[model samples]
Target: MAPKQDKKVEEEEDAIYEVEEIVDHRRSKTKHNMVEYLIKWKDYAPEFNTWEKEHNVYSKGLINIYWAKQPYTLTQFKKKTHEGESSIPKKRPASSQATKIDRKQLAQEIKSSQISTSPPTGLVWTDIDAIVNVFHSEPNTYFAEVKWPGGKRNTYIPTRIIKKYNPLKLIYYYESQLEFYLPP
Candidate 1:
């Protein structure tokens, strides 16, 4: 019985030591905080790593030792701190920064402008009348808001199938729409 009790004590000590050495330190970004460190268990894969508060890990003295041993530069630290987000400052929506009257005035200006009715040379108007607005574009695709002669509006038309049409104007128009409508 005495021998068994001694062996059990030894096993508990070994378990404590295992926990001490198993901490693998890494950093991450959280919504509330700009920077955080993820504590990964030595024997576990990266997917199982958990985000731990700096205060909690610092109290244990594990992170201090880890940071001292790692030879990372300032740029690397910034990169780690801002992981999962763009480095560039996001632009706010134009409407949020402008007055309601200004927005109404701008809308009126856009509505009053006369876009050319005739299709560019070699392009046929076909079933549509004129391009009134544009919504989005990608590498090989473009979406436009078109108007018909009867004052009907088609909000989404793919520009790729339109023959002899250059999509630059539509792409520029879409970007402008994003500037006005999208919240950063």
Candidate 2:
């Protein structure tokens, strides 16, 4: 009888009982229920553009979130105090921009980053524009610089070498070994 009651409560709660496997964009130690996080953004963040926390988060934050390509557990994530955050500049990625940046010798650097980072994920893929940007951009660039797309350039990167972050490649996150798929 007690078990039956627990089930009812769980169902009524609309419990998000699963999580998807995804990579941590920040390289930080947080990869719990990435699925729920993205899903929430897709469902409620914005109709077409980025999704920012209307009250807790700021603008351009949503752009950064999508670029991460990670997942989080809805139930577990919501339980937290929800105060952690980072700065959100007033900009979007190169994809959302009109101006284009082209650098020389970017292919080699991206090839290196890919060669070094690829095997772990099994594969990686990217569009021609990103491929061009990676080749044109400098090497070992961080997500923040790239997240803004055309807003802020990664000048720290050597123009002599460039690399791209191909989304097609299958990156293997340590969390992927687990079995959890968020609601469609």
- Top TM-score: which candidate number? 1
Q: lDDT by residue for model 1 over 1-184, one digit each (tens)? A: 9999999898666551112332444444444333356666555676776666555443222443344333442245546653445656343333544444443553344345532434434445654565554423345654445655555534345655443464555554445334222232
Clashing pairs in 1: none
For model 2, the superposed segments whose C-alpha errors exceed 4 Å read 1-38, 41-65, 68-88, 93-110, 114-184
The stretch of ten residues in a row with the least summed lDDT in candidate 1 is 16-25
Candidate 1 displacement at residue 127 in angstroms: 83
Best by lDDT: 1
lDDT of 1 at 78: 49
TM-score of each: 0.23, 0.19
